[model samples]
Target: MKTTFEFLNQLTKNNNREWFQSNRAKYEDSYNEMILFADQLIEEMNKHDVIETSVGKKSLFRIYRDVRFSKDKAPYKTHWAGTLRRAGANRRGGYYFKISNEESFAMGGFFGPNAQDLLHFRNQIALDADPLRNVIESNDFKNDFGELLGEKLKTAPKGFDKTHPDIDLLRHKQYIIRHDFTLKQVHDPNFPEIMSEAFRKMRPFLDCMTEMITTDLNGIPLV
Candidate 1:
């Protein structure tokens, strides 16, 4: 199997839509390969008894990049990205798993300036320091991302004041767990074991999110 690192390196070199069009066959081949990789990842998670929404059954992969408003204006992306939505809430909300030339991550909750709920959800994350701390303190996180997090947190974006009323409201709202790691690092043989350990440590938070979503949806709980 080609590691994500190899795929990403090739992707970065030809990120333009025209290049993608000319190399359409290669793109299709890579897309099919990534679908298989995602399935393998799901199978690995299942072996560890981790419960995740069904993504493998359907071809959830997407090669297009929606850039109608963005300044960069790249209509297509060379990298493949995909998301595994929760069973019924594909449009409204669900976990997002993305891979790109730069990095790969599993981000739950919402994002974008217009995604009010997601932004609210992100704010809620700041309320409890433990979860965030747990992610930051993990050996994998420390070894790979300690410097990046330290720099970003030290100079957080404007209007994220801890004392603000919006911030307070977020503190009370239900928070979702999101974790990201660089694709290059994850492709390492030792990385799967590290990621599995991290996931196990974060299972309680994941369970909490599943429970909260179930209660909110009036649906059966995952646990």
Candidate 2:
């Protein structure tokens, strides 16, 4: 973990093709280390939660940055990240961790759903807000995530009244939660357990999103 963070820190300072190619071996090592860590996290999480994705490089994100349309135009990314989700799940959200010099966090939620999907999600909240509210309001969830964080409309979304009781919940453009971590904690041997617990705390929210998105073939039936 320390080596991984070190590599990422140095990468931030030298985010260029030349430096990265020169240090390809180090990058490979860090990549493998992340895969191993992701595998371990999968095992630990499975003890309490069912995950569809298997342990391997597939679950880890590529270090290369897609800079085609980006203004920064950095050829490589400064951090490595891994994700775990149900095996066949499309884009319903997953458990994710990112390692970087500045800050690292464990996060989960339905992120940036398409316009049609977003409407369904907001409708789910408008119709049945208690289950989602209970999860986000729980002591463990609050302690871990602090609050539901995501983009929201300035006023209310389409179809929902401004005076709706759960209008606040219906305004979200994304459903996500994050728990920050330090480099020291990432290097701890118990880091896998730490990740598992954090993901566990997020299960209720994940489950809620999963159910809302997967059910109702025509999209969350307007209720």
Candidate 3:
């Protein structure tokens, strides 16, 4: 990780096509190391969670940036990131990691849910917020995630009562929980175990969300 971090840190100071092309060999070495680490990370991850995406190499995001829509057009990204999908139709969340000089973090949950799925979440909360609330408000969840975090609307979403007791939950446009790690932690020898355990802490929230998003308000399986 020191090598990986050094490469990325240097890239930040020299963020141009010429510099990346000149350092291609170094970049490949760092990239391969990241892949190896990710592979180990996934193996440990499957111990406590079911991951549909098995190979770490395939899970990694491309280092190249999509510059067409962006104003700042750096040819390559300054970080390494990957995402892991939960296995099967019943499992309904993702696990992600972003490694960079700025900060490193791991996260798990649903993001950008479709309208129907969002409605399902709101309906479940409106029906009885306890089950969902119980998970997020628990000691384990708080100790790791602090609190539920995601994009939310200031006002209640359409067709939902603004004054409802659970309106806070209803206004969510996305649902996720995250754990940040220091650069030292990211570079730790036991990082694979540490990273995997951080994700393991997310099961209570993820399981509750899987139930909410994959079922009708009456608890009928949607899929």
Against the true structure, what is each candidate's TM-score? Answer: 0.55, 0.87, 0.96
Choose the strongest candidate by TM-score: 3
**Model 2: ten consecutive residues of lowest lDDT:** 214-223
RMSD of 2: 3.3
Candidate 2 per-residue lDDT, tens place, 1-223, comes to 8778878878888989999999988898889888888888889988977678877577888888888888989988888788887544533577788877787788888777899889877877777888788889999888889999888899998788999999888989988999988778877898988878888878778877877887674454333
How many backbone overlaps does candidate 2 show?
A: 1
> How would the candidate models be sorted by TM-score, starting from the highest?
3, 2, 1
Better of 2 and 3 by TM-score: 3
Candidate 1 residue-wise lDDT at 151: 10
lDDT of each: 0.49, 0.82, 0.90
Residue range 1-223, candidate 3, lDDT tens digits = 9889999989999999898899998899999999999999989988887888879898899999999999998888999999998888988899999999998999988878888878878888999899989998888888889988999999989998899999989999889999999877888999989999899888888989988888787888888
| Candidate 2 TM-score to native | 0.87
Clash-forming residue pairs, model 1: 110-118
User: Lowest-lDDT window of 10 residues in candidate 3?
Assistant: 210-219
Global fold similarity of model 3 (TM-score):
0.96
